[model samples]
Target: MPTSRELREVKAHFYSLAGFPNVIGCVDGTHIPIQSCGGDEAELFRNRKGYFSINVQVVCDANLLIRDIDARWHGSAHDSTVYHNSFLRARLDNNEIDGHLLGDSAYPCGRYMMTPILNTSTNAERLYNVAQIKTRNTIERTFGVWKRRFPCLSQKLRIKLEHTLAVIIATAVLHNIAIQQNDTVSIDNSPEEDIISAESNMQPLTSEGNHYRRLLLEQYFM
Candidate 1:
């Protein structure tokens, strides 16, 4: 496990990247399929498709150093629900996290977290969306690196759910270490990726979510 100070340092360094401020890091959850363990224990890990799996939530900075992670739940749950019940909830509720979080549309728009809408047309929003897309790419890239480096994550894990979290966290810690060494972590990218379509699903925040996001953005932007 990383010391709290080390985690904070990683968080601060990643958020310091250009155009990113007060950012605790980018947060996302990935599905990790697990082998059946049998009995009631088996049902808890079984997902919608009857496949045993766990949802791993990770928060990483601009450099892809994971600062915080939560990986104990089954994959049948929704990402938003996991986040709502996560430690992120406490940090967000107390206004402890500094900058807005980046995530895919699986998460809804809210203060301290931003996701592109399904439709947006204004020029300013367009520009803002562009920057978000660029920054959020770092997390996806990190995931690719993680799956590649630890082939165990690319396929079904034979370990029990409890043990799986430990393995994932250990891998995250090592990933950050490798990044510090200036390792090459690459993900396949199309030559002509369209930023607009990539972010097209972004929607305006609802009154509550929008007001909260604006307040957080203002606090950091200022």
Candidate 2:
């Protein structure tokens, strides 16, 4: 978790990119391929893509440094489900964090989680979507960098499920360290074949969330 001062700095950096205010981090999920568990629960590891893997939820700052990660969910789990069950969600719900996270439409919009608007008829709405997408793309780029740094994440991990989970979290820690040391990999020429598309099963926003988004648009995007 970031301190209050650090969260403020992250929000400023994100706002500078697209004028999206109060954004502390970008959140998303990625599937990590792994060998089958070889049991009744083996099928549980198979995702919609027909691959056995783990659905890893990650939150990254504007600097592409990972701030949070949950690698315990199976590949078949919905991105929103994983987030709802995460410790980060609890912290956000408790107002322990001062800023919101930018996620795709698959997440339920709330005071702490902002998702893209589905229907846009006004120029303010359009601009809001554009800024949201631009700001939210950091998580995607962070995944690319992390996977490129550790090929094991991109490839199938032939280890036990317990070990696989440990490896996933360990790599994320190493990724942050690499970023801090200015030791980053170039993902410019990376292929897009491995990139997972954003889930389209959009979740409904809370009444408070809808009102908050509207306020944001009127205050900033307008």
Candidate 3:
């Protein structure tokens, strides 16, 4: 979670990219492959892509700095489920944060969590989607850079699940340090799969969220 001052800075950075206002960060889930900890509960780690992994929920600013992360969920868990059960969600629900997060359609829209509109019948809505997506892409880029810097995240972690979780956090911390130090790594041409997918059992959008999104569109995009 960002401080009030940091939130303002992040919002300005996001708005500069695509004119998306009041966006504090971009949120998304990325799967980290892991070796099976064979047991009756081992099947719980198998994801939709038929791989054993952990579903890590991350929130990053426009500078590609990770602000928050939840790497406790198994790969089988849906992105929405991970978010709903996250401490960040509770903070947003309690109005602890200052700005909204731009997530994909997989996340439920709320006063603090803005998701893309499914049906856009107007130019304003379309523009809103474009701006939102452009600003939201920072998380994807952050994931790409983080994984490229530490190949262990892209490849299967051969350690125990407990240790794997610690390793994930450690790498994320080191990644942030690199970003702070202005360290650059050449991104190769390796194909990074799109991890953002629709949830079959989606969470219902809140009325407040719908109103907030509409206000943003009419105020800035229209």
Candidate 4:
């Protein structure tokens, strides 16, 4: 485990290079299945998918370099709830983050975490969503690179859940190094496919509910 000082240094350096002032990083949770391990510890690994796994929470900077991460929770825990229970909550409460972190709708919007819910109908709301999408893409892209580069993350590993977290962190640090070193990186997306994907994922909204959601999001983000 990295000492507190070392961890702090890493986070500071990461945010500095990322050029996002006061940003603690983008936070999200993912489930990683683990093979059967007997006892109460094993119980913590069960997920809503009816699989055994651990919930991994990561905080990455604007540059997509992980500043801090936690992976001790059971897969069954909600991501938002996990954030509340994790050290990240203390960091946010203590004002350790310069600005609120960006997250997906799975997490509720808070002073410490900014999330966008499809609650808008105004032209202004449309603009805000566009802006949010642009910034939020960074985190999604980072996850893509992280998972692709770390094949072990895509498959089951022999290590204990706790030990596996260390491996994950080490991988994140290495990913940062590659990004810092100016390594070749490419992102792929087809405009047509993207449109289709978005259409499939979009939720329908009632006129009144849409208006309210749009107004609420505008007020909150503004």
* Candidate 2 segments exceeding 4 Å error: 189-195
Shift of residue 176 alpha carbon in model 2, Å: 0.8
Residue 166 of model 4 has an lDDT of: 81
lDDT by residue for model 2 (22-127), tens: 9989998899999999989999989888999999999999889999999999989989899999999999888898888999988998899999988799999999
TM-score for each of the candidates: 0.78, 0.95, 0.95, 0.71
Ranking by TM-score: 2, 3, 1, 4
State the lDDT of candidate 1 residue by residue for 71-121, as single tens digits: 878766666767878987787779665556877776778776777544555
User: CA lDDT of each candidate?
Assistant: 0.66, 0.89, 0.88, 0.61
Tell me the tens digit of each residue's lDDT in model 4 across 1-222.
223455455445434442322334566776666776778677667776677766777776566676667877776776777787888789668865445566666665566665555756567566556655555556666766777677677567678655877887788889889888876466553121111122222323335434644454556444
Q: Which pairs clash in the backbone of model 1?
A: 22-99, 116-202, 116-203, 117-201, 117-202, 117-203, 118-201, 118-202
Highest TM-score scorer: 2
Off by over 4 Å in 1: 1-21, 41-44, 48-50, 190-204, 212-222
Please estimate how well model 3 matches the true structure, expressed as its whole-model Cα lDDT.
0.88
lDDT of 3 by residue, 1-222 (tens): 779867788788889999999888899999999999899999999998999999999999998899999999998998989999999999988988888899987888988888888779999999999998878888888899999899989899999888988999999999999999999876654435848467565567899888998899889999
